[model samples]
Target chain A: MRAIVLAEGAPYAPAPLSASHPLPPPSPDTTLVTIHAAALNHRDVWIRKGLYPKIVPGSVLGSDCAGTDESGRRVLINPSVNWASDPRAPENPDIYGMLGLLPLPGTLAEQVRVPSRLVHPVPSHLDFVHAAALPLAGLTAYRAVVTRGEVKPGDKVLITGIGGGVAIFALQFARALGATVIVTSSDDSKIARAVKLGAAAGINYKNLDWRKAIGAHGPFDVVIDGAGGEGVAVYIKSMRPGGNLVVYGSTAGSEVPLQIPIVFLKNINIKGSTMGNEAEFKSMLELVSKHEIVPIVSSIVDGLERAEGAFDMMKNGNQFGKLVIRVHEKHHL
Target chain B: MRAIVLAEGAPYAPAPLSASHPLPPPSPDTTLVTIHAAALNHRDVWIRKGLYPKIVPGSVLGSDCAGTDESGRRVLINPSVNWASDPRAPENPDIYGMLGLLPLPGTLAEQVRVPSRLVHPVPSHLDFVHAAALPLAGLTAYRAVVTRGEVKPGDKVLITGIGGGVAIFALQFARALGATVIVTSSDDSKIARAVKLGAAAGINYKNLDWRKAIGAHGPFDVVIDGAGGEGVAVYIKSMRPGGNLVVYGSTAGSEVPLQIPIVFLKNINIKGSTMGNEAEFKSMLELVSKHEIVPIVSSIVDGLERAEGAFDMMKNGNQFGKLVIRVHEKHHL
Candidate 1:
């Protein structure tokens, strides 16, 4: 198997592309997957830089992929594992971790082995590049927007940092659910791009009064935010009483400054959500298939040799959608 | 009717024991209740000190009351109004405000007029004073512990500020639900009182390492918190993944400092809860009746003439239970 493994070095460069890797041993519960396309995520960037916890230097690095299984079934891998079917949380701690990290091999390879239960058929409308983009970000958005937020038709939904792959998916999913989506970003071009992608409104967080913009579009019904900082105060203020604030990541800062009284008085719910359970992954795929929702692939590099450029694009933080790697031609067996 | 009315003064003292006030006008949707007893809350103290919003001069100022209706029905008033049975939230904002404020008459009076729908039968186990304590605090606790927290049997529960009427109620309600209850208080004596009242364990928040004590009892499944500030960090840190931290008040500080990443990874739910709607109020009364739960009353003043003393005790915060005013004999009928 040719794989993308972390390279141990002084600077800790994640050379996620390796030509020499041993094929995984066969297991009764596991099946081999031949990856046709894989996508870059923030997790890949962190693992490559050796910033993620419990880093195994030789571990593969990727969480999202669209590929084929041994029985010749078209599939997409659910990177989140050990969650059982519990929507509330994983059955156990630590074991309910994502793929592409220690102990679990990643999908940025010609072949990978995974538990059979974590595999699902790819949405027929999507090609491998687009299908690769769906596994991680789409599942996250499904849980955050559809499951946690419970966004309804005509609901006003606000998603922050529209440049991230998850935020873009959230916009699409919320829109697919018939919600009026609003977006926030520091980049006006990204805001414009989000508007083109169906956002009802967009605001630049850099504004001295960025919060003022929210009042016009919504006292939003559901707010999907990953930027936790002083910025949260405005989200708290702008939400309707009993609104849900679903969070999956914290790219901006870890400390959230919240007005405690408002949360109590407004009946607000702030939930911490992450990569979802396997059931949610299937539901995510169902929604994607039913809506013919194509994964937003911002850029696709030709092969694993250009993996550095893809990872760099993710690291630089300006990409608006998923960055995919074409591992093989769609016709590959 | 003699009502406890707000005295229009510079240092606005709540004359919560008016000798003579006009009786509330009769209305088609309203029913008159002859007050036998009323309980003092932190809300009463805030209104008395003129610290609460929208104070109307000469308006009555109390929330929890147990009395007899015009039809001689033994009743307790649900102070939360206009919520229209939606367990999620009030159908509209502002109109869902509690009693004892402007536009709504308070319970601290010889007779109070309220919507007939907000009146319910008092639990047979409690006398007037205890029943008075049940309305506001018990409803808040029932919503926090039972509704939002959804505490199940064997769930470990944490209630902070056991001195508070609501927290005490939460402790009792969670225990009655077959949960193992833990309480936190700054006063050792209050912790002792909470233990006597059924807490499995108690920790004094005054201790510099208060959270360390929690490790022995649990990583709590549900934490009912009223005091929010830097202290919330420890509460968040000490909860299980998918734990519910229900906030109904912010007595310590309004700003809560949260570790956003932990919230997302642990899938913690931070929800703001207040007094429940009509349906939850009925359910609360049912639970109280079924369990024969008694409100922990600290002191019952002989009459409204000593209402100041009861209000002062609530403001000083050393009392371990509710301070109530006995307006009339328990057998007023």
Candidate 2:
């Protein structure tokens, strides 16, 4: 089986393509998936740079994928694995792992074995490439916006770092829920592009008083942000009283000064969300199917050999949406 | 009406007691209560020290009060006023006001006029002093523990600053909900008292590795905290996955280094909760009545003439519970 294997070297070492990786056999509770398309995420970049610990050399490296099973049914793999049975939270959150994150083999390989329950049929309207983009980022956005943020009809929603896959998905999900979506980005061009994608408004965070600049668009009912930094305090103030700030990442570095009085006095909720439970994953797919929401795929590479280019693009932070790898032809069986 | 008023001086200047203040007149929508007892809060102390802005001169400076109404019914007043209609949050949080803070007259006077809705019948089990202690601190604890934290049976709860009024109430409330309560305080004697009040365990946060000291008692399902400081980052790591850390104050200073990855990765929720809504207040009173919970009042001054002494006790951080001013005899009608 062909796979994108992490090279054996120091952090930031380039991973190379290999066609001689051994194929994983299906366990009794697991089924074989022939991946047609897979997508790159910040996780992959971080892993390549050795920022994420316990790097397993020669391990397959993609968390999001869309492919076919023995029954030739279109399915997208749920990357978040080993979640506890509880609906409210994972039973052992500390030990929870994702596919392609060390112990679990990712979807970059042409064939992978996974628990049968983790596979869900792709929306009929989406092709494998777009379907591949929806697993990790989509579920994350689903939990942040729809479940945690509780974006409702007529509610104003703000999503920070507008060009990232999760932020883009959050915008789409909030808009699909009939919310007025607003976005913020350092790049005005990306903000403009996001506005074209049904965002009600956009703000360039480069301005000293971006919060005041976007005052007319707020106070937002929900804010989906991944950046947890000193600036987050400003976002808290921008929210309506009792608004939800659903955070999933900290690209801007951790350690934010939180004005405690403002949070409690305003009845604001700062919910820390991540890759959701299986139920939320199903709901995300259902919403996608109902709305025919195609993930924003900014670039597509031809094969595993070009996977490094996708990773480099993500490292550069220039891509506006998901960067996908065409593992096989759509007609492959 | 006798009351305590902030004197014209620098921050931390002593406020003076006055017996010649005019009594508050009851409006059609308001009721006049003859105060039998009123408790001093950290808020009262802070305001008297000029830490709070816009301190109104000649204003009575107490928030928690228990007294008799025109009908001679025993009552306690909830000082949070003019909340938004929404049950989840206040309408305009920035402008939300509390009695005795500024602009609003407090309960330090012999008589106070408040909207009828803010008054609730005191449980028969409570004396006026104990009842007064329950209104402000009790409501804050109820909101933090029962409402925001969502503590459940068998859940392990952590309340920081165990000796404070809010912390003590949270300990009691969590225990009432069948939770295993743990506390953190600088004073070991306070920890001993908390354990006597049904706390499962206690940790002295003054120790550098307090997290390790309480490792066996955690990862807590809910952590009701009022102190937000550098130590909060460590507490975040101590929470179980999907645990709630309900924060109400920032006595340890407002800025804290929040490790964002730990928050999202653990799926921990840091909720900011303050005085609860009217519905939550009613529920709190019902719970108090059901459990026959008596607020812990550490000291009782003979009359409003010694109200400044109560404030001084709080400012000195020596009181373990509430400091009450006995305005009149408990049997006053």
Candidate 3:
């Protein structure tokens, strides 16, 4: 077994992973997955740079992967584990974390072991690469758009950071649910690409008055945002009374300054969402299957040895969709 | 008819309300009520000082009232009106506001008129002064604790700014619903008084480490807060995973700096609640009736001519519950 390990040092200038790491053993009630494809996420980049919390050395670093089980069934791995039965939160949240984070073995290796229940059959419409792209980002977007944000038919939905994996999935999911989708991105080309993917409109958020640009088309019913920072105030102003703003991640700083009076007076609801539960994971896959939606694979590098190339592309933040590593050939299993 | 008008001036500098202003007229589908008693909220203080939006010079300054309607029925007015049919928000949120704010005539007059639908029959257990104290604060608290906050039996609930009308009502509501209630106040005597009123514990927020005092007992299921400022960060830290922090007012300051990552990672929800809708007002009354809860009235001015006394007390923030203006004799109806 060969794996990519988070070598010591900052996230940038990392050539930490090695190809000859020893194979990890599978425990009872856990199945060994021969990973055919693995996807790189911003989380991976953050962990490698030591910017994220609880970074452990020698831990295989990936949260999204697809492969085959002992039963020879194609499966996608849900990286979120140890969730509480309560749909609202994870069990032992202080210690709760996703795969590739500290303590958990990620799917960056030739073979990885995970709890049996965390495995779901890949949607028939997807291959190993697309399935690998769907779990972490797809489930997060599903919870933000459908479960918490409560987007409905004809609802006006806005997804920020349009080129990111979660934002892309949220756009597609909202469209599938009959919502009129709008997107925002820093890059005009990425915005254009999102519009081509069926968004009703797109805005380059780099503009000083980006919110006003979106406001021209909004008073939106649902806003799926991952950037939690000073810019959240502008989004708040754009919301209609009683609108829902669902925040899934904070890539931009975490301390957000809010206008408290406007929030209550306008009857706006700000919901903070995260990785989502097992049930949501299942629902996300079902939606992908029913819609026959093919996830966008922005760039692909063949062989487990080339995983760093995918990481580099993700770090650049220019990719429009998932960056994948073909760990093993699809027929190898 | 006689009423108090918001004269142009700084809110705390002078006696802005004059008692000899002309009376207001009732609208269509509305009924005139000879007000027996009226209550003052912090909103009145803000409007008087011109700190709130949409301040009109001649508008009557009150929202909570108990009086006699046509046919001599004893009733209390529900200040929230023209709520949108959507369960999530008000119909015309921009214009929809409580009584006595601008646009709507408040209940601080000798005679007041309101939409007939906003009137609820006073519970048999209450008199004019207590009934008048219950509507604005009661409805806001009920919406925060039961409807939006989703407090359940045996839940540990935290109510901040316990001396205020809405916070007091929230304490009573959560306690009545079988929740273990804790309260915070800057005044030690007010905290002692809240504990006497059935709060399980109390902390004087004046202490620099007040959150540390409460944290020993918390990981609270629900926290009902009125002060929104730097202290909000401490409250966020005190919450357990999946906890709900319901904010109804921002008397401390409107610009609240929040720790964004903690909110999402803990799966905590920060909900902005205000005066409830028509349905929730009705539900609040039903709960009041079911529990036979007697609203606490902290001070009572003798006549509508002395309404300024109630306003002054609210500005001082010394009262532990509602401050009322006895507008007319109870038997005058």
- Best model per DockQ: 1
Give each model a TM-score.
0.97, 0.94, 0.93
Q: Order the candidates by DockQ, highest first.
A: 1, 2, 3
Best-first order by TM-score = 1, 2, 3
- Pull out the clashing pairs in model 2: none
lDDT of each: 0.86, 0.84, 0.84
- Give the Å shift of residue B154 in candidate 3: 2.2
lDDT for residue A129 in candidate 1, whole number 0-100: 91
Q: Model 3 — interface RMS deviation?
A: 1.2
Global local distance difference test of model 1: 0.86
List model 1 lDDT by residue over B189-300, tens digit each: 8889889988988898788777688766678899999988666888888899989999988878988778899999888999999998988989999999999999999889
Model 2: per-residue Cα lDDT over A78-186, one tens digit each = 8888783465577665677889966788888788888889989989999999999999999999989887888999999989999999999998899899999989999
Task: Estimate, for each residue in A205-318, the C-alpha lDDT of model 1 and write its tens digit.
Answer: 898778788776778999999888776888888999999999888888898778888898889999999889988998899999999998888999988878888877887888
Best by lDDT: 1
Q: Model 1: runs farther than 4 Å from truth?
A: A14-16, A329-333, B14-16, B329-333
> Relative to the unseen true structure, what is the C-alpha lDDT of residue B325 in candidate 2, on a scale of 0 to 100?
84
**Highest TM-score model number:** 1
Q: What is the Å distance of residue B154 in model 1 from its true position?
A: 0.8
Question: What TM-score results for chain B when candidate 1 is compared with the true chain B?
Answer: 0.95
Model with the higher lDDT, candidate 1 or 2:
1
Worst 10-residue lDDT window, candidate 3 chain A: A8-17
Displacement of residue B216 (Cα, Å) in model 3 is 2.6
